[model samples]
Target: MKIPFSPPYINEAVIQEVNSALESGWITTGPKVKRLEELVCKYTLAPNTLCVNSATSGLMLALKWYGIGEGDEVIIPAYTYAATALAVIHVGATPVMVDVEKDFNIATHEIEKVITKKTKAIIPVDIAGWPCNYSDIYAIINKKKELFIPKHENQEKLGRVLVISDSAHSIGATYKSEYLGKITDITVFSFHAVKNVTTAEGGAVCINLPEPFKNQDEYNYLRCFSLNGQTKDAFTKSKAGDWRYDIIYPGLKMNMPDILAAIGVAQLPEYFEKTLQNRVEIYEYYHTFFKTKSWAILPPYKSDDKTSSCHLYALRIKDISESERDAIIDKISKEGVAVNVHFQPLPMLSLFKEMGFDIDNYPVAYNNYKSEISLPIYPQLTKNELEYIVSTVTNAVESSL
Candidate 1:
């Protein structure tokens, strides 16, 4: 019984959507992309959304739009993927790394400790589809508002540090009965091949700024900014005598094409009721099977106030070293079960190590990484496969111990 990890749920409906986009003869950032953005806004109940080539680009675009550049500092959890920190680096800003809690989210107290006059943003990642504590983060931001020094007009308008949620793993996830997109000032959702929803390689930026700052105006500017600052996109220029346009700012080419957006359009309609529901079932199955095991520590998915997207079933083993965890993964693989680690702490990576980050400083992140193993939790897995995965992981852990 061979089980693969996180394959995109591409069915006939997805194929038809892509075919329609291919046959339309207008593929680059056109009606389909606009339609996806509209669907995302409707789904998340956000005021506006901007589709980009990737989540990394979306994060960078948000940072640039806020004028967060050299000498500025943005706070991020050290447990997240490098893309979170890389986005800050691309904008010439320093990424102030902080520790995560046992629930695999940025510690709000750690965020408070790092707040400084140069702090411009706080990017809290929703690890493995679990929503971060935005309410606590907001409280910290409010308490430290006096420490924030606005450098740009947009920054001044915002009045305090911006909260950009690295929601790559959490699209349909909810907190306190509200979807994740509108939870923060800016939320970036990834549609990579392995995500809950796939656009092949795309992302959407949900804009929900407080009043005095118009979200629609920000969306319009970002839309243009994504297309190399062109006043008119190629699809618009294709119209009769609409070729004349102007460059507003030197922006990056980060717009999503119609073809990729087509995939998301087809998936989102069924996401809540079907796709996400299936993933949740798989998550529950794993939890039920592992809850009885004294050696197993299950990841959080549902509570009274939060519901996860169930992107990854990251299971941690009790009392294991990092090398022991690696051996267990090896054993699982030998049984034809594919598994993974959510991430290594950023400081453990060579790039961050060279930047003076030490994994020892982020004990919780390192602890989580050492014993963690991400099992497959996609909509396509069957009951038989689910049993196989659990049996295999149980055998692997017991043998390793």
Candidate 2:
């Protein structure tokens, strides 16, 4: 009856694809990587895409691409993983941590309060597979356009604030009937082991910037930039008499290798149907079981205009103290059931604490974090195991209370 947390869904097809890529001579940023990018563009409907090593790399690259640097400010949710805010910090920009709504996405109401002339970008995180309210975010940014200061070339080109989505958990999610990458100005998707769709350790960036910046041109630049700004990659460099290459800029080494990309290519065909559907069923059952209990507060899975990828089942035990929540987790662990917390508010972390961000300032984020418990849900989970989990969780919470 042992239950583990999230695990990668690796099938024989995925294995064979990776094995075939290994058998193939080219591996780094080759045909397979290109295919994954193409598939992502088709799936997300993003005009341009660049496959990178990780979502953190993608986010940092986007911040750098937009010329967000020292003295600039980027807003992000306090409730997300450290990578979201760390990306802003890596770009030398000040990250303005904001609160999140109960759905675990950035609080749109809190965004306006932090808006300033120095605000150059806002990285809205779509946590737990739920897409952020992009329509609301866009409206807020559009309303405050006049107040936004364009400090760099990329900034001046758009003459407005950039919207970069931290979409690591929400690749297949939809907002207003549109996929995540298309909803924001730019979106970053992670393919880490625990994600719904994994490429071992990879991610991609989707560019949906304003006019005057053709997506292909941006994509080409990003491709070169990611490979240490080399004009030609090893693939092209291998061709006869094409040995020489030039560095366009001092850039990052974050390109995805073809071996990893092969897994993604194998995953794309059945991602929305089989894998995501499995997590969705897990979410539904959790809701069905927890709804009978008055202590249960379920995460939002769907709405008239949106649908989740159903990545994490972030359940909240209402009217409980943080200590009680911890106790419940301990009780569950004793029964061989594994669980986790989505995140502690950024301010609660040491780095942010030193930066002088107090968790008390974000009351809503703190409230959500204190009671939140993430349940295990993956495609391989069986019906009997799922039933055991629900019952175990129910007993754990009630007994702890």
Candidate 3:
């Protein structure tokens, strides 16, 4: 009974959609891509949505759109995957690292402490599909509005710190009974293979800017930005006598093609109807199995105001060193269960270390990382597989202890 971690939910419907895309001949940034964007807007209730090749690119685009650049600072959680920090770095901005709360979200007080005149944006990550406290974060941003010094047009228009949600793990999750995308200024969702909704390798940027900043206008500009600044996509150019186009700004080649978008198109309906429900059930099962164990620190998946997408069951073991946790993971693997760590804090990684970041500075992030094990929580896992996973993890933890 070999159990793999987080496989994509690819049914016959997904294959059929891909087949239809292949047969259409207009496979690159065509109708399917537009359709996927529409479906995302309809589901998330965002004012506008733009599909991109990856969430990294979406973050970069958001940063660039806000005019975040050299000498500017962007606040991010040290506990997140490197992509969050890397996006800031790619835009030539400094990533101001902050410690996370016990629930694996950026500390709002920490955010307020580090904010300066140079702070341009705050990228709060929804670790393991659990949303951060947006109401508090927004209040903090508004409280610090006088300190903001806008460097560009968009920055001036926004008049405060931008909140670009690193929502790669939290598309279907809700914050305060509202979907994540609409709750923030801008939310980026990943459709990577292991995500709850996959497009093999794709992402979407949802825009929900306030008055005086038209979301449709922003969406249009971002669409062009994703396509190397071309005024028209290949699909539009393919139409009779529509070859004429213009290069507006030097942009990135990050647009999603129809073929990949097809996967998301097929997956969205099933995701809302069944896939997310299955993941919630699996999450509950894991919680029920581990609640009695004193060593078990269960990941938060549901609350009165928030409901997780159940992306990762990031269970933590108590009183274990980092080395001990690694040993437990190895033991579980040997027993034919595939488990993983959510992340090593940025300061623990080689890149941030050379940049003069110390893991000790982010004690909470390091503490969270040391004993964490991400269990499989996907739509495809069977009941037998779920039981096997818990039993295997329990044996490994007790033995390691």
Tell me the tens digit of each residue's lDDT in model 3 across 8-41. Answer: 8999999999999999987899999999999999
Off by over 4 Å in 1: none
Please give the distance, in angstroms, between residue 63's alpha carbon in candidate 1 and its true position after superposition.
0.5
Per-prediction RMSD in angstroms?
A: 0.6, 1.0, 0.7
The pairs that clash in candidate 1 are: none
Runs of candidate 3 exceeding 4 Å displacement: none
133-233: candidate 2 lDDT, tens digit per residue: 88899899999999977778888888888999999999889988888888888999999989988999999999998788788888888888899999998
lDDT score of residue 2 within candidate 2: 94
Model 1 C-alpha lDDT per residue in residues 1-401, reported as the tens digit of each score: 89998788999999999999999997889999999999999999989999999999999999999999999999999999999999999999999999999989999899999999999999999999999999999999999998988889999898999999999999999999999999999999999999998999999999999979999999999999999999999999999989999998898999999999999999998897698999989999999999999999989988899999999999999999999999999999999999999999899999999999999999999999999999998988999999999999999999878
Q: Pairing residues by index, what is the TM-score of model 3?
A: 0.99
- In candidate 1, where is summed lDDT lowest over 10 consecutive residues? 268-277
Whole-model lDDT per candidate: 0.95, 0.91, 0.95
